[model samples]
Each structure stands twice: as structure tokens, then as C-alpha cells.
Target: MFDTWSVRELANADHPPSVPLNPMGALPCIARLEDETGSSWWVAATANRWTTTHVLVLWRPDPRNHRQERLVWLRKADVRPWLHKEQATRT
Candidate 1:
């Protein structure tokens, strides 16, 4: 879960695809991903999932420091719009 990665010795990842709001454009990415135990996932220091609502991707930059952060949270309705925007933006 987020806690695992958040507290791990090494937690970090590149900027996840920006949310659909920013005009910078969109990148292909997964959402609300879960692990085998049917619980939130914490792999490679990347945490995906927020609460029980399945709406967030919180990335950190090495557990050495929690100051570095990048967050992406989207609603159920944002899925389609985000996907459509990405498809159209793709070359």
C-alpha cells in the first residue's frame, strides 16, 4: 500500500502521467492497480490507490526524503475523459 512505499528505505518514481486537467498533455498509464491479496499495491516504491475509492497515484522520491512528491488523483468520471484525451493526443 501507500504506507509501505511511503515508509520504505527507497521510494521513488518518475512523474506519472499528468491528470486530465493539465494542458501539458497525457501519457499512457495504469490506474487503481491492486495486488494479489486484493489490497493496495506497493511495488518499486510506487504506490497506486487512494483510500477505498480507488482514485490516486502517489509517487515519492526515495525514502531518504519525503519532501519530493508528485500526486495524481482522478474521479470515476475523469477516466473516460482522460483516456479520450490521451487517444487524441497520441501521434
Candidate 2:
């Protein structure tokens, strides 16, 4: 069966990113996702829309290994648009 997660049930032990990373390794974080059953916010998911319902995510400081981050595919509905405070100020 297709898995359905309410933004919380989604896995944090993410899969390695399906694409390349920015050489700078900066948090070009474009969106956020909730973690820990929606009790807390995991606010560092970067999004590149890959489809109508899925997003390619760059989850930093991976829960499984801090030294290396991972890339994960998440449902678009499970994530919310995020803007860094600096960006928010400009727009």
C-alpha cells in the first residue's frame, strides 16, 4: 500500500538526496516539515518541486549521521513553505 504520513509520521532517517548538492553547503532551505509526531518543527528541509505531489528534499544534519546529510523525497502536502527571516524581511 502507498504510505501516507501526516508530516509527522514521515521518516527523518532520510534517504540520500536523489540529486546534487550546492557546493557551498548552505541551508538554502525553502520549506519546512514537522517532526516528532507534529510536536516539534524540523525546519531545515530544502525543496525542489519534482512533481505535483512530491518534492526533492535536502534534509541537513541527518538524524542518522550528523557528519553527512541526506536527500529525501517527501509528499508536497507534508511540507510547508519557509522563508529565512532575512528573506522574509525583503518580501
Model 1 lDDT tens row, 1-91: 2554433322222223543342332333433423344454432323244333324444443545778755645443232222455567857
- Model 1: CA > 4 A from native: 1-41, 44-53, 74-91
Clash pairs, model 1 backbone: 11-62
TM-score of each: 0.23, 0.43
How many Å off is the CA of 60 in candidate 2? 1.8
**Cα lDDT, model 1, residue 55:** 43
Checking candidate 2 for backbone clashes, the offending pairs are: 17-71
Candidate 2, residue 6: Cα displacement in angstroms equals 20
The lDDT values for all models are: 0.40, 0.51
Please tell me which predicted candidate would have the highest lDDT against the true structure: 2
Q: Judged by TM-score, which candidate is best?
A: 2
lDDT of 2 by residue, 6-74 (tens): 343444433334534433333345444445654434545666535555566666544445565555666
In candidate 2, what residue range of length 10 has the lowest lDDT sum?
A: 1-10
